[model samples]
Target: MTRDKILVVGANGELGQALLRELGTEKAIAATRTANTPHVGFDHVRIGSDGNLPVATLKRCAAVINAAGSVAGDDQTLRSANIHLPRVIALAAKNAGVPRLIQVSSFSILGAAEYIDRTTKERPINAYGRSKAAAERLLLESSSDELSVECVRLPFLFSATKPGLLAPLLSLTTRLRYLPTVAGNPVRRSMVVYADAAKQLVAAAQSGLSGISFVADPRPFDYALLATILAEEADINIRILQVPRPIAASIDHLLPALGRRLLRSSLLDPCANRVGDEPLGLEEELRKLVRSTYGS
Candidate 1:
């Protein structure tokens, strides 16, 4: 094993795989509790639990990239994976004297946890978001002074493997052709391609930056605008169904519990919606997603 080892947690995941791809040919370890299939050159190690992460895994690692997240796992499982895992990883890294840690966190951490009622605040309406938010806090409050941790709060991540924000919404609209545009559901929003998000993460890891970075498309894109693009580019035709704002939020609140999870993620998910208003740009890099996904 090379002295400069990078351990990528959740290497089997879409973003994790992308991050490994970005690392390309570097001496790295890919870990997952799930069975690992072929993924580039790295060997897969099964960590059934966060506490089960092998010490030898950390012994030779120079940096640990935590791309681990649980979307549908049990509440305890999700909490263990998201919150407990990061803390354990940080502690391990600190003990091993690793220099940097790159944690992939969710954009939802910035939600109105303080302002909105806990019941209504969109901190994380689903198991996935809650896990990520808790994990983000763990990473933030990590006790490892030796670990230079970089937490990236990411918006919707797009890739061929997993549907991005636009693709899922577009998929839902494909059959219906029309979607209700509610007052609160901001049509324009910011998102990032999985590849690009991975690239930025790798870059940040290489740069040795120790802080939080908000990663997303540098432009405001609305669902209406996105729907139009998909219809034109992907050749899916749909109508815009305008629903009331309160109804949309209400629907967002009840859908998961009722098992009627939105076919397309809620545009009203508090964190995802606020990204549109942040200071971002229409960089040349972002236009590539349009071409790649929608075609020229």
Candidate 2:
């Protein structure tokens, strides 16, 4: 229980686990819903949903990163994860003498938009979005010098975990060698891979970054570029099929009800340089992913 530790909530999650690895066991103590032995080199503390995070768990922590959140579930579940949990964590962190709390939020807070800039505000078009936005508002209202709070709007991530959009897109590369370059697809959008996003979270927690900000890869990509990287790297053409931009975009429209939205080439902006000077390394990262996941 060193006083310099960081308590990472939801340490079992994709981003949370990455953060734990990035921060290392020496500085990180995992705070999870239930005690478990999954993470080998670190420590774990129970953070129950009772809105009562054990103060002792955070006592030694200089900061807390709320990687715990829900994107899909019933109304109660969403509200609990996105809203209640965050508010509770903030209170616990402040009380425990933790100096900073970095909350994990989603870009869904900006619901339907083709292009977004600094001027865009939260106009959530869905329940999940609304829930996340509400959580953010709660944190902002409570922020103070004693326990500075910051919410990071993490976008659809691309990683080996195959986060929502990447799962389908990466599926296409396992079996296809020849991919098409489409009109809408030079679509550089606001998205980042998991490891990069985790690093940004670490930076935010360490700096006690103020206000709400967005995170994304410094580089941009679309169907052809991503697909080529996978096919060339994996050398195994087995499982995914990428459609052209117009076709993919149309599919996105046709299934608005689908929980996982397809990656539309619509220009999604994550606010430039919000992630500082980290190189996105999209090509190399994807190549490694292909080898690890689909390569022989």
Candidate 3:
């Protein structure tokens, strides 16, 4: 019997590579912009950053997982990758009769939508968030019941492979004039270990789960609490200041351009903060992140 063919766009990406490992030993095509080391169950294809994917090969695949994304530039490369690439994939999948397509999106889009003006609303205040939001919208608009198109809006992701949210925050702690104060807001957010997110993603693909789903930390906490935990692991003490929402919002506007410089590619671009509205086990995941980053 022929095994199902899974194609992973951006297969060389941090998340894509991890997801490839999780899928393990499947008949899959891993697409990247440059040559990469081959994995056991997959064949590597060097694709252009532009949407010049192998259409014929794509058609034969059973599912397509798009992890390709970008942020930065007067180029608006994000529009092509985040918006056009997915649309092309969807259309190709439809023609090829592929059953499902999973697009990875950012939680920031959800956060910034209500707060920012419409002109830049869809376009993230930060470059990265704009890319992700555009990609998510493209996926949603292109999908229908006939094809199983699902968007996985991920929050802050953590893993040993790279220093994530905690890294910069920990760095910030060192420079603080004083320990920041904890805020009382029960803001919802979700995060997942890269390995865990990969496992769930591959499993969901194989299981053929439909509709939109979010994989996040089962719990969420405010920044102050997060800093405290990091400080504990790092063997330092810290405090937090609770900036009121009005002040926070004002800052978000005043520093619109500051986002690209500070955030780069993170979900924490305060302008595009998409804290989860649903329950997510963020604390437990943070513990894992701390262990991985600081060592158990």
Clashes of each: 14, 6, 19
Query: Distance (Å) between predicted and true CA of 191, model 3?
Result: 2.6
How well is each residue in 1-296 modelled by candidate 1, as lDDT tens digits?
Answer: 54477788888888888877877756657888777643856766776554556777677777888888776678888887788888887887787777788888875654423222113433565677877767766776773567788787776666544554445555566667776665544444445666777777777677666666666654544555655665555666667776776777677577733222232232323453223444333333333444565566
* Tens-digit lDDT string for candidate 3 (2-86): 3277888888778888877866655568888777745654777777555666766666677788887764555467677677887
Clashing pairs in 2: 171-240, 172-240, 172-241, 174-238, 175-237, 175-238
Q: Name the weakest run of 10 consecutive residues (lDDT summed) in model 1.
A: 258-267
Against the true structure, what is each candidate's TM-score? 0.72, 0.84, 0.73
Give the distance in Å from residue 117's predicted Cα in candidate 2 to where it truly belongs: 2.5
How many collisions between residues are there in candidate 1? 14
Task: Indicate the TM-score of model 2.
Answer: 0.84
Q: Which stretches of candidate 1 lie over 4 Å from their true place?
A: 1-3, 34-37, 48-52, 111-122, 143-145, 164-168, 183-186, 234-296
The residue-by-residue lDDT of candidate 2 on 194-245, one tens digit each, is 8888888999999957788878776655655665665577554432244566
In model 3, the Cα lDDT at residue 236 comes to: 55
* Full ranking by lDDT: 2, 1, 3
Better of 1 and 2 by lDDT: 2
